[model samples]
Target chain A: MHKKLFIPGPVDVKEDVLQKMATAMIGHRTKDASKLQRDISEKMMKLFYTENQVLLSTSSGSGLMEAAVRSCTNKRAAVFAVGAFGKRWYDMAIANNVPADLFEVEWGTPTLPEQVEEVLKTGKYDVVTVTHNETSTGIMNPVGEIGEVVKKYPEVIFCVDTVSSAAGAKIEVDKWGIDVCITSTQKALALPPGLAICTISQKAYEAAKKVENRGYYLDLVKLYDYIQKKDHQYPSTPSLSHMFALDYQLDKILAEGLDNRFKRHEEMANYVREWANKHFEVLPEEKYASNTLTNIKNTKDISVKELNERLAMRGYTISNGYGKLKDKTFRIAHMGETTLPEIKELLSNIEDILGL
Target chain B: MHKKLFIPGPVDVKEDVLQKMATAMIGHRTKDASKLQRDISEKMMKLFYTENQVLLSTSSGSGLMEAAVRSCTNKRAAVFAVGAFGKRWYDMAIANNVPADLFEVEWGTPTLPEQVEEVLKTGKYDVVTVTHNETSTGIMNPVGEIGEVVKKYPEVIFCVDTVSSAAGAKIEVDKWGIDVCITSTQKALALPPGLAICTISQKAYEAAKKVENRGYYLDLVKLYDYIQKKDHQYPSTPSLSHMFALDYQLDKILAEGLDNRFKRHEEMANYVREWANKHFEVLPEEKYASNTLTNIKNTKDISVKELNERLAMRGYTISNGYGKLKDKTFRIAHMGETTLPEIKELLSNIEDILGL
Candidate 1:
């Protein structure tokens, strides 16, 4: 039996969506491919609430995350980290020989707008990256507020990693002044893990054009140029299987209605948080807690590893705290196709197993 | 009706293999995921005839092509271009600011062994990249002979792009002293286009370690280290759908027996060549012709684009000449799971459509 994935991503995809992965292959250079891609981009724009040109890559969200930093950072980068995912942006900058500085808050704390303003005031940075939702600590940062602050710096490109957020929450890209927003299919999009999509503002493209040494494969400027020249087709042969599924799934998501989907996610998040409070303590404060997943402090000091193992036997699974927080915290994801009833069942099972 | 893919890549995958792509998702960090990847690497070793470590990337083969040039080329790179694919190697190196020089041959020509030796003798180049098969011109370069020449230079890392020929043809990585051999799943592997696999020898790893700025996402050294430390697991969340399908398809490939598979490809190539010679001029000399795809000169000066459109109407598709060779030549791919009778049928349809 497959354990229900209540972990961050690679969530329980719907059976109908999985069937779309088996769609017949198509020549990527043909008109059919361009139409498939164009339709996808149109839907993605509606979801992101932006007029930015959306780009698709045959990689995990990390691929585009790396692309954002390597392609957009010209002078220097200020990466604000709430946890592991934010730190990855900094790591990518350092790996690519891009000059950068890391401004990391505590694992469970959100990156405030004032802190971002202070960094931009330095006038040494050309790029600013923030984690819209940190999967590790379950802290959803105030990206709208941060975007307001970043708008004051016309030269700085604002990029956000919404890998685990996106469809579960409202991301007003244009209103937030987001230059680039990156997310993968597996998270709130509720598809498999092969493709990553991002919205690129014209400013980000112009900023990237000024920077040299944006390596091929992950070069954002080059990708933008190719899509413009090729009528919505990508430079490389993209995963048409993923595109087929995404196109279908996006319809399903839109049919659910964006406002209703966001509301459903919030309801699930509140239920999980309430349950966590009764049993243990929520890791992050109520205001900053992520709507996609809830991180619970392991105050009872249960063996999270063992708990997960037992949960697997019961056909339910959740994530232990990521990296340094392992054993100290546990996480329950309510994103993807997971619903409130499913969350209640998982909690009930956990209660039965733990005899709480 | 779905048109069968006859292009170089994104080939027609078997229905069973396509179904495997719809396999249920699994956490990339799990032991099961490690087993799946480990199984793939072992089988890939047999296919490539090497003991070198096999690394998988979620992006297309170009991703790793850029990785090889960026990570291993420290002093300088000598890129040999027979056609578009080879030129891409040089393009990637230049994009990443890796100091490199291109030694290009005319279209439909192979990179000769003596030419490679002459370039290596210059001693300024520490990395040499060759396209083993040029999909555009259907010229399978004399890479084994070129490898013999590159072996003399102990300091130069040899990289080969076998994207179109890796599984359809035999590649003796260790015997050829090729440090990095790259191929994608959509080609001879008969899988989807989302995954690319490569073999990296210890020498390549050591050379990459000395490089200070290997970008993150496509960083070969970082990937190698992570695989070693994590029991064949990748650092990023890999496309589990691809891995599941690859693991299943590699079994079918091994069951087919490598020698038998190569013989089938050669037999199909010979059959296609005979038809091409009788009807149209064969692009590239017979000695250098690729066994996977045969590029035929449009000797009669017929409209290749119109031919493809007509072919598409009959539930079939073929490629027009690529780039500069467009309309001058047309191509038919006989790789992947394509059979001899299917080739005969396709040719018969083209003959009937064109009044050959």
Candidate 2:
């Protein structure tokens, strides 16, 4: 039996969206391919609330995260890590030989604006990276306030990993002064995993131009230039299937209205948090908690594995805690098209299974 | 209204195989994902005829092509370029700041074994890249013979871009002493674009270990280690949809028998070549011709654009020459599930359209 995915990503894609993946292939270099990408880029601009040039990659969000650090950081990078995904950017910087420093807070904490200001004032970093929503921690960083601090540092490029929060939350890329905002099809987009998208500001592109050795496949400068040169085409053969599904899904997202989508996510998230606090306890502070997924503290210390196994029998799946948090805290994602009533149903089922 | 893709990639996939792309989502962290990847890897090992570890990337063949050069090359690389794809590896090397030199042969010419031997004998290169088949030129290099030369140079890591050739042609990766052999789903594999698969030998991994700063995402060593540590799970989320389709398609490929599939490709290629030779003349030498696609010299100076427009009306499409060869030659691909009769039918349509 196919379990309904309430996990962080690879969320249960709708039937129509899944069928778009089965559309017949088209040549990536053709005019039709260009049109498909152009359409996606325009819709993505709406999702990001930016006029920044958007780039698509046939990769996970990690791909563009690596690209952002390797391409824009000329001197050093300040990676503010509230959780695992934030530290991954730091890891990418180090792996690519891009000098970087990681300022990590407690797992459930969010990277505050003052913390970013303190790091930026050091002048050791020309590029700053922050995870808008840390999937591992369920803490949403205050990027808007952080961007106000970043705006003071004219030399520093503010890059955000909105991988798990995009479309589910209101991320004002232009208003936030986010030079690069990275995301993927999975997570809140409610599509299957494959394509990674990022909004690239002209400032980020300029910074990237100064930084040599950006590496092929992930070079933002080249990617930006190539699209202009080739009429909205990527450097490599992108996943046309993903583009088809993404374009179709984007239309559905627009139809529902962005405000309605965000409100739905917020409502579901608040419900999950309230239930968690009533039955157990929420992991992250309620004020800083993510609107997409809730990381619940296991105050009952129940066997998450056993619960998941039982949930599988019920044809549903939620995530066990990530990394060190395993069994200590479990995660229930409410993003994508997951409705509040559906969230309540899963919680009720969990209560029945555990006798909470 | 879908034109049968006869271009280099994004080939027309079978309806059932395409439907596999719509397979319901599974968490990348799940045991089920591991099984899917593990099954695909084993089947891929069989496809490449290698015992080397297989790594899958949610990217185009170019993504892995960039990875191979970036990860394993510590010393200068000798890139042998027969066509555009070959030059791309050199471009990748340069983009990543890897010291490399390009040895470019004339377009439509194959990278000869002796040429590789000469470069290796110089002792200036510890890594050498060769395109197994130049898709632009429709010329398949004698990689088996080049492998014999490569085996003599123990210090040199032999990397082959079999992006357009792997399943459609015989590639004994072990026998060829290839450190890395890369291919994507869209070409001869007859799946939609997105995933890139490559085999990494122990030598290549050891070389990667010696090499400093292999960037993340495309980092082969990290990818190798993560799968080993996490029970075949990738460090990043992979395209589960592609994996689902690829696994199903591999079974279909195997069911048809590898030899039978290759023979079918060869027969179709032969028929296209024969038809082209009688009318317009094959672009590459008949001996060095590709067993997947045939590039025909436009000696008659007929309009390829017009020919394709007519062919598109009949639910068929072919490629004009790539890059500089545009207008001078036109190509008809016979790879994937394209049959001998289909090739004849396409040729008959061309004859009728052009009054050949």
What shift in Å separates residue B330 of candidate 2 from its native position after superposition? 0.9
Alpha-carbon runs more than 4 Å astray in model 1? none
iRMSD (1 decimal) for each model: 0.7, 0.7
Give lDDT: candidate 2, residue B144. Answer: 91
TM-score of 2: 0.99
Chain B TM-score (model 2 vs. true structure): 0.99
Clashing pairs in 1: none
**Candidate 2 C-alpha error for residue B228, in Å:** 1.6
Worst 10 residues of 2 chain B by lDDT: B338-347
lDDT of 1 at B15: 93
Residue lDDT tens for model 1, B127-201: 999999899899998888999999999999999999999889999999999999999999989888999899999
